[model samples]
Target: MADTPNGATPQQPAQVKMQVLAQYIRDLSFENIVAQKGTGGDVKPDVQVQVGLDAKKRTAENQYEVLSKYNITSKNKETGDVLFAMEVEYGGVFLIEGVPEQQLHPFLMIECPRMLFPFVRRIVSDMTRDGGFPALNLDTVDFMTIYRNEIERRQRESSAAQPTNA
Candidate 1:
């Protein structure tokens, strides 16, 4: 393993340190259909949003790529019609080094997502509020729980699909 520029030896054996290299809004799209209609002068708008997260290794190097995607929809309550739809994908490059093999999964699935989520949340909030809607601040996500659930689900599916040698 290469020594960190600080020259301090890793405290743990092959310790992994995740460094945020760069964070940016990769893509954003918003559409306001109701605003174009020029109607519903008194009706309040209802908004719903969904978010997703994904991570990938950039290369054999210590770099990682994290993606946070959001889908938001706004509707005019009175008309029961779509008002606006927005989608945004925020991404960042992270440097993970000296990580032990056993700890790599947790480091990538939990810690990395935790580190990247705040930036993604801010973008969604800002975009919604600035786009003439209320701020859509998201609640904290339990990535560990999500990861475990995903693993369990996959395992169950795989086991169910396999044939037992009777």
Candidate 2:
């Protein structure tokens, strides 16, 4: 290790810094398909959920916008009837600095979305509760896993889309 003029070991500066400039609800929807009083109130519904992620460079220097979208549908497996549904698109403007290009994608996809998830989850839960149902809590998502899976899927699609001849 190299020592500075003050006889102290030099420390590395921050490699990356992320700031959430603004966050807002880009879109939201909620529907209650079944009446709570119609059934016997013993209906255990199975919920299907889908989640998506995206990031784009804004017209600003060292800044990017990240969006996380989710869809939830509740259905009664036995009766085959729709109970409720919800969809949300949440986004945040992030200012990132000092990160290398190779690391920027992960930072934007994983870190930025991780920061915005709590708010989105809250919105979903509140919306469901307000829509005449119990509050729905979203499970903690593994951003790293999702990011890796998406990368692999895109690579496979691109490779298959290319032409090959014997």
Candidate 3:
């Protein structure tokens, strides 16, 4: 390796280009078959939601797969009946390269997710409210925490299954 004037290897600048080639809700489902009977005359409704994030390598060089999925179930507690069930999957392909290893996780978790979230959020809110129920608003997620937890979980599982000698 060539050394700089200071006798240390020169660090390469990161080359990162983040662009949203396309943004849309990939899949959406809303089930309100029982809304009429459950709400007991179009009463107020409550919704509970869960969100998850996942990433994978795409076929193209330096391309990535990022997905944000939400599962929401709305109910009328007083009647102990279901109001609506919705599931949505939002995903995008990101092109990135030359980014430092330390910054890669943040780029995917924070920056990429931020780009895709608004579209997803709108779908959830619009669909629920339009379906004759209160809007379903989701809280923002901390992608870094989710990414780190996933890594740690995988490591723990692998370590547990491996032989001690190996």
Candidate 4:
């Protein structure tokens, strides 16, 4: 807002802004640990995908780097043979401005990762398909639940590590 008629800043009206400054794949690896059996016939493999989130402050002001890590394992449940395994750490640099300090952590953990997930998911699907397996379609992630779980886990750990009165 243009300075008040009398030249006062007016607190900037509490603008809340968040933006993705840049995004990239920090690490990506696909491993076929064991040979995929079956001679060009219909195969049903059990696929397991694990997703994790991590974030750290960047050197620039109001910038942060958040990594969405994924570990996927595909196997034949009947034979317990590993068909394929993939690990990717996709990262995004976010510019967070005008948000309260209390809200910043959640913004980075939940919102930032949520924004970057689709691209990472697409890459994973493409990688799996390129590796001679059926494309692995991923479902939407529930980041809020993950965030809450992490908070609870950390709280429990903090309490467990503290010394009790003798």
Top model number, TM-score: 2
Tell me the RMSD of model 4 versus the true structure.
Answer: 3.6
Where is model 2 poorest over a 10-residue stretch in terms of lDDT? 34-43
lDDT against the true structure, per candidate, is 0.79, 0.90, 0.78, 0.87
Superior candidate under lDDT, 2 versus 4: 2
Q: In each prediction, how many residue pairs overlap at the backbone (N, C-alpha, C within less than 3 A)?
A: 1, 0, 0, 0
Quote the lDDT for 162 in model 3: 88
Q: Hey, what RMSD does candidate 3 come out at?
A: 4.0
Give the per-residue lDDT digits (tens) of candidate 3, residues 1-166. 7999989998777667776665667788988857555434754456787777777777887788788888988777676577788999999888878777788766876678878887788888899889876677778777667777888998999999988974
lDDT of 3: 0.78
Candidate 4: TM-score?
0.85
How do the residues 1-166 of candidate 4 rate in per-residue lDDT, one tens digit apiece?
A: 5788889877655787889999999999997655544334445689888889999999999999999999999877776677899999999999989878898899889999999999998998899888877788888989999999999999999999999999
Q: Number of clashes in model 3?
A: 0
Any idea what lDDT model 4 has? 0.87
Model 1, residue 164: C-alpha shift (Å): 4.2
Candidate 2 C-alpha lDDT tens digits along 127-159:
988999889898998999999999999999999
Off by over 4 Å in 4: 1-13, 34-42
All candidates: CA RMSD (Å): 6.4, 3.3, 4.0, 3.6
Worst-scoring 10-residue span by lDDT in model 3: 35-44
Higher-TM-score candidate among 2 and 3? Answer: 2
Over the stretch 1-166, how does candidate 1's per-residue lDDT look in tens digits?
A: 5677899765656655779898888899987675677664676777776766788878658898877777888777787788778898878788988987687776777787788788777877887778777787877878888778878998999999999998
After TM-score superposition, what is the CA distance of residue 100 in candidate 4 from its true location, in Å?
0.6
